[model samples]
Target: MKKLFLLLLFTVVVLVACASPYDPAPQLLPSYVKNVYVRPVVNNTNQYGLEDKFTKAIIDEFMRDGRLSVVTTEEEADGVVVCEIKRYVLQPLTYDENMVTEQYKLWVLINVFFIDKHENVTLWAEPNMEGIQIYADSVKGGFGGMTEEEAREYIWEKLARDIVKRTIKGFGSTGGISERKVQD
Candidate 1:
């Protein structure tokens, strides 16, 4: 009985020593930041009207999340999200026997930053946030595929979700391009 008791005690000790303590919900954002304002997107690329659509998408995403209030003005917000559309590249990925493009890859790159309104400082900046979609060109008759506009809408949705997730879930939650290779 004595030996059994010691063995049980030793097992319990070892188990306790090997166990790791983890907090299920580690606080990622400051408590004071409850409202965020998404500034109008600035499009640096030559793609026209991309800023408006992307800006609306991000704002809609934040509203849909409902975790933080979306404010119209900077003064009313505790945080501000600034976005710049850096690059838009659409290229033919696959071609048919007649040299007709069948599939195309559309990639959009943007730089996003979260700024602390109170401190007037950027908390985080994702410089190479990118969204890409490869699809069959319906115009090229690739089995009734999607149009460029449709593919762009898909990209916007995904990037918007990623932006919202990054904001709500904190750093390292979403992945983006590490280094930009887009040249002038």
Candidate 2:
């Protein structure tokens, strides 16, 4: 009986080890959502012109992706992408011996929603979507560092890519902030 039990345990272990890894297929957006209108991004932070740059980045990303037609008006679109810049933070990550900031971290937080205009329902909502970058100061570090504007541009590109991926690939591509932080 002991030999039989050991054999059974070994068989179970072998079967488990031989099992194929599960990979979930990416979920695509609804077939009806062939076109989208990106509303002008709203900036809540004191930073100036961030809305324009971010909005342009998103538009450019959609155009580059070629998966969805970008429409000029909501009426012409099957879906609408709503974006709002909620927060922007720049902090010193490391300081030099002189107490000067040598390295900095930039963070941009946003809320994104893709609504099915025909159904009058939001198909997907990403609240507190964020893009972050860390770099050394150009004057203090060995490697030439990016200016604040350059850092902002980098963040815009990252966010635009994420937004596009979330729209085209649907769930599990990216994670938003904790649900507890999101308010109605």
Candidate 3:
């Protein structure tokens, strides 16, 4: 009987140790941000399709984060986030004799701002966020010969993920929430 009681107590202690600790200071997440407005991105670059692509990327990031309930229109949203595409350029890469050993490099620059409805304050502003992606081309094809649409697609996915990660990290840091790791 004594042995059984000791075993039970040990098991309970181990179970409790394995559980996660409850956060004492839970950050106040805005309940009013139940809906979000994603405005159309203003494109300053000559690139034709950059505006739509960047706009969709930001919306998708917000949706995937699961923290904010996103809405399409401003009328239904509590706040609005506006994004601008400042630059999109493709620079050619040339080798000996200007044979164009490699394909063009695509660079993208963006700016984002978030606004609150009731307080009428800008929550966040990130200017000059940039990303670069490169693709290779065959010798037979010149820089202009290879289509970079597929490359853009791949790069956009990665860029969107990075943007979300940065946003989350910034939120946590600014909210004064610290993450600590426990060793096994």
Candidate 4:
């Protein structure tokens, strides 16, 4: 019985020793990246001024994160974040008794990338990144409903938060296969 107990203990120790932690993906943002310059967001959709709104939102999020300083120009930045708005979709969901729209779904698609200015190489890119939100139209009671501007703000905030989170976490460390390639 003593021999069996010792064997079990040895087996446990061996198993524990063999256990290894999960290896995360490589860091996309190098440690030298101190300031990030947010370029003007290119707007592909017909929505005028959306580019400015998204650009402002992204800059605000980066500032809020405080991981990297936001620079005004590429010359002052160690890295640059380029974004292109690809699509904007709004779909009416439910309808009121008079055929009035009562609910809507808003979706925004964008392509974003981070480039190291000194090396002039892409650190990471999230093509086709999407943000979506659902909102109700103003009802008779004027409750549980939001205006289009309100919905837009909500979606923008969420997207900015996501972008900042992904950027600050070193890009590829998000526990998934990154489409962006790293330079050796």
Candidate 5:
């Protein structure tokens, strides 16, 4: 019985290892989409300088991704990514001793659109998309915890990655992106 169980386990492992990876979302954009320009994000919320941070993050991410080329102008690019900051909110999440705020959450709602410059049409749009992060506050005000700017940076990184993934791999993708190279 032990010998049979071992054989069964080995067979299962082999099958699992040999199985192909699945892709949940289809490639909606054409293969020619290589050069991309990220527009300066418009901020509707009252948070000063927040849009600039998000825009810079997205540009830096696209340049680092290596799959898409980041261009300086829309006229010179194959596609453009437009973003708008719809809302920003910071709320206290946890309380420590004496009802002091210990943890806080930062949330932002954004609208995004990927436009094909040649076609002059939007390839896809994600409106009212939200990103959030939670961090503990410093006890004394400058040491062992995260500040508002740090939290925003963390959230910006997350949003930028998601935007790049959606634009390159297609929105709502579940599995890993199969294609790695983009035509120049």
Candidate 6:
């Protein structure tokens, strides 16, 4: 019994010594981004209204993160985020010529640029931040296709969330927060 107790005590001591303590580091923000400027998104695509949707989404992302202060104009900001709508397409769904169904998929593509003014650097430029959402054809049949306005609303919300999440993760990986900011 004495030997067993000693062995157990020794095992506990070893286990305690082997365990590593958590040491939190200091939080750090991006070196180049002190202030962010969100430009009015330009729509260069043939599809109408996409430009507005993308622009609003990007701005919403900046607001949600609340990490960097946003500026109205690029000249006033330390970093500028410029975006463009590249494509917006809704393909029709038809089972046959005689019997047409109301269902469609909406696709949207946007280009995003993060530029640093002071450093004259382009931190990130992605030409393809794209998303797709499906909508039914008619409200009555429970299979109705999405109207243009409805599709816009759906796509905008989805794009905003996606852009916000991706940007936050990217910023974090690039040292958006200091070690001290990380919760235990």
* Model number with the top lDDT: 2
Task: Report lDDT (CA) for all predictions.
Answer: 0.84, 0.85, 0.67, 0.83, 0.83, 0.67
TM-score of each: 0.77, 0.81, 0.64, 0.79, 0.76, 0.66
Q: Which tens-of-lDDT digit does each residue in 50-160 have in candidate 6?
A: 676667767777787787777877778887776777887887655445566567778888876666576665556566888787777665355455675788777777766
lDDT string, candidate 5, 13-67, tens digits:
9898789566465756678888999989999998899988899999999988889
Candidate 1, residue 39: how far the Cα is off, in Å: 0.6
Question: What residue runs in model 4 are displaced by over 4 Å at the alpha carbon?
Answer: 1-23, 26-28, 139-142, 174-184
lDDT, candidate 5, at 88: 96
Off-target runs (Cα >4 Å) in candidate 3 are 1-31, 94-98, 138-147, 166-184
**Candidate RMSDs in order:** 7.3, 4.5, 10.6, 5.2, 6.8, 8.9
Q: What is the lDDT of candidate 5?
A: 0.83
Candidate 2 vs candidate 6: the TM-score winner is 2
Screening candidate 5 with a backbone cut-off below 3 angstroms (N, C-alpha, C), the clashing residue pairs are none
Better of 4 and 5 by TM-score: 4
Indicate whether candidate 1 or candidate 6 has the larger TM-score: 1
What lDDT tens digits, residue by residue, belong to model 2 across residues 1-184?
A: 9999999999999899889666666667888889999999999999888999999999999999999999999789998888999999999998878899988999999999887776776777888999999987776654979777888899999999999998897754444212332223
Number of clashes in every candidate structure?
A: 0, 0, 0, 0, 0, 18
